[model samples]
Target: MKDTATPRFRFIDHTSDLGVVLYGKNLEELFQNAALTMLTIMLGDIPELTGEPATINISVSGTDLSDLMVCWLGEILFLSEAEGIAPCTIEIKSVSPTLLEAELRTVSVDPSSIIREIKAVTYHEIKVEKRDDHWEAKVVFDV
Candidate 1:
């Protein structure tokens, strides 16, 4: 697919919270874009890390794709806060309606690299759907 034709993400602001939502033509793409969106929120702009790459492995299960999306992103957020790392790229190993696994590659964050801290992932206004050939999801992050 053309780069411009690939998945995309957008930010959504609520009364007291901010979040990201994403859409793609496939489940893997959707998850990948969501990871990018989450990283953007944490780093504003994803920094180029040329060395000492760290890999994060995540597996999440839910009853549906929407819940799975939340869990998948939540795992990334959890690792970022707990491990003090910022992911710049993601590779989806597998994805199903109820299960997802991925390898997240990132670099350790410098003390000054943190722009915003995300506290949790929320279920508010979360949605996932298959429209035409595309899959879409909206997720909220608690900052």
Candidate 2:
């Protein structure tokens, strides 16, 4: 089992949409890191929730790891776009190949602070794989 305490991911340049190449020690970490990446891209930094942090629970379903990744990030995108909520921390409690359950620690962001408006998470050029000892995924978002 990999350490669930810290997850990792990085952003990549994309011609049309936002892109990220994520790394994790395992599948659960991959999902958690992907959520962080999505939030960072939206806020243009690692978000810090001020005042009282709001907690929101999220559950997303997919048919496989790839699909689940898209769905997981897509759910976060939806919250930002439709609800004006941005997450500072994402605690993924349970994750499987087809399902994810998480608690999002968030803060309400002013509409203007949404530096990058991501319209949707896409499957274009999406791939999840294991390389050497870690899992990596390439995700693209429609802007």
Candidate 3:
């Protein structure tokens, strides 16, 4: 497929919250982009997050793709907020509407690098859909 997951995300203004729209060629790319976008929101443009890489194996599931996205991103948040780890990249091993497995390259999350605290990934306005030639996801974060 054409690699359409390149562009990252666009900011969506929310009242007392953070939001974004994510794109990808497929579900794997879409989920990967979602993690990256969440990272950006949490830490800003932290090029230094590329520090020594560590790997994490993850398997998450939900009732559907949208709920699965929430589970996926929720893991990303747990790594960052609870474990103090920041994922720099993701290699999605496999994905279906209800399940996803991936290996993530990670680094320690520096407390000082945090620009915003996302309370949670909200369900409000969350969407994942294939728009003609590519996939699109709209996600809102609770702040």
Candidate 4:
């Protein structure tokens, strides 16, 4: 199958915090792209890494796709904090309106290489919906 285009994420800087706003054609793509953006902030030019791939298994549930997206990214942050891992690739195994399961893979990074650490994923200004058969969502990361 031809690879689908990935989602687009924009960084936003507030007086007190930094975050990203993301848009995608589907829920899976939205979540995957958000993760990529977050990791990019943590490690710049991720395409330059030649390290071995690492994998992460994630499962999350929420009242809606919007909430689910936040929860999904929250798990990734948890992995970074607890396991010292940074994910570069995400693969969705299954997703529903309220639940999602996926695998994430990335190489390790030096603690000093992280310029900014994301504290959490938030529900603020979050949106997830379908437009002309394409799914889309917006999320903000707490940095």
Candidate 5:
């Protein structure tokens, strides 16, 4: 979402849920883009950095890369719905298969503007892989 331009993330056909295939060049970019994509799905579009931005330092650990991906996006969902903070910019300083550290530029948003309610970042069909030139992740959200 930050590095891969044309299609940051694309929708996948799902009968009963919402899905996206996220793209990036590395694990850090992949996680950063994943957070951006999750925010877009929640807010319909990425909201501009409007006012004074707040920096949020986030660190999450997982059992593996897949679980790390899930935890990464799940934290975004938690921030949006529970904290009333919309992510504007994501800067992941460190990322590994088991640990991720990031800084998010966020702003306060009107909760009513949130059109879609993503209940959770589901594990169904979730994937994170390194391709020949890029990294990709398949994520489905429970709506």
Candidate 6:
């Protein structure tokens, strides 16, 4: 078990790739935290969007919890790398064992603020589990 008393997500230092541990009281919050973590990593600064941020819907499906996390974060990465968007906020509207749907509020990225480019979201040491009353996930990115 890891610390769960403070922020919902925290970055983990990795020798090569980027990593984060996400905590949530439910699946919705878990996914939301995951998205935020990825955005924070990509943007370097937490974005505060105002005046007509772009809104988009995202959906992904996977076979299990760990797979779901990868797919979910992968979509977020796609929005950044391919679509030139950095998410300001994520609202996980619905989630189930194998599927997720969310609304993202985003803004165009500032290329210089991107600390490092995330090549992909990897399966390395991915874990999603319930501990006490909340769920936690550990994810590593191929940067």
lDDT of 5: 0.88
- Candidate 2 error regions (>4 Å): 1-7, 11-13
Least accurate stretch of 10 residues (summed lDDT) in model 1? Answer: 1-10
RMSD of each predicted structure: 2.3, 2.8, 2.2, 3.3, 1.8, 2.3
User: What are the lDDT scores of the predictions, listed in order?
Assistant: 0.79, 0.83, 0.86, 0.72, 0.88, 0.85
Clashing pairs in 3: none
The sequence of per-residue lDDT tens digits that candidate 4 reaches over residues 54-123 is 6668788989888888888788777666577777677888889899999877667667777777788878
Per-prediction tally of clashes:
0, 0, 0, 1, 0, 0
Off by over 4 Å in 4: 1-7, 47-52
Residue-level lDDT tens digits of model 2 in 1-143? 25555446666888777788988887777788888888777788857868999999989999988999998888888788788888888888998888899998988877788888888889998888887778899999898
* lDDT measured at residue 80 in model 6 versus the true structure, 0 to 100: 81
Q: Would you give me the overall lDDT of model 3?
A: 0.86
Residues 33-138 of candidate 3: C-alpha lDDT, one tens digit per residue = 8998888888885335465799899999999999999989999898898889887778999999999999988888767778889989988988999988789999
Model 2: colliding residue pairs: none
> In model 5, which residue pairs have backbone atoms overlapping below 3 Å?
none
Per-residue error at 112 for model 6, in Å?
Answer: 3.2
- Candidate 6 per-residue lDDT, tens place, 1-143, comes to 24456687778999988888998889998988888877777776657887789999888999998999999999988878787787888889899989999998988875666787889999999999988978999999898
Better of 3 and 4 by lDDT: 3
lDDT of 5 by residue, 1-143 (tens): 34434577899999999999988888888888888888888898887988799999999999999999999889988888988987899899999899999988999878898999999999999899988888999999999
Better of 4 and 5 by TM-score: 5
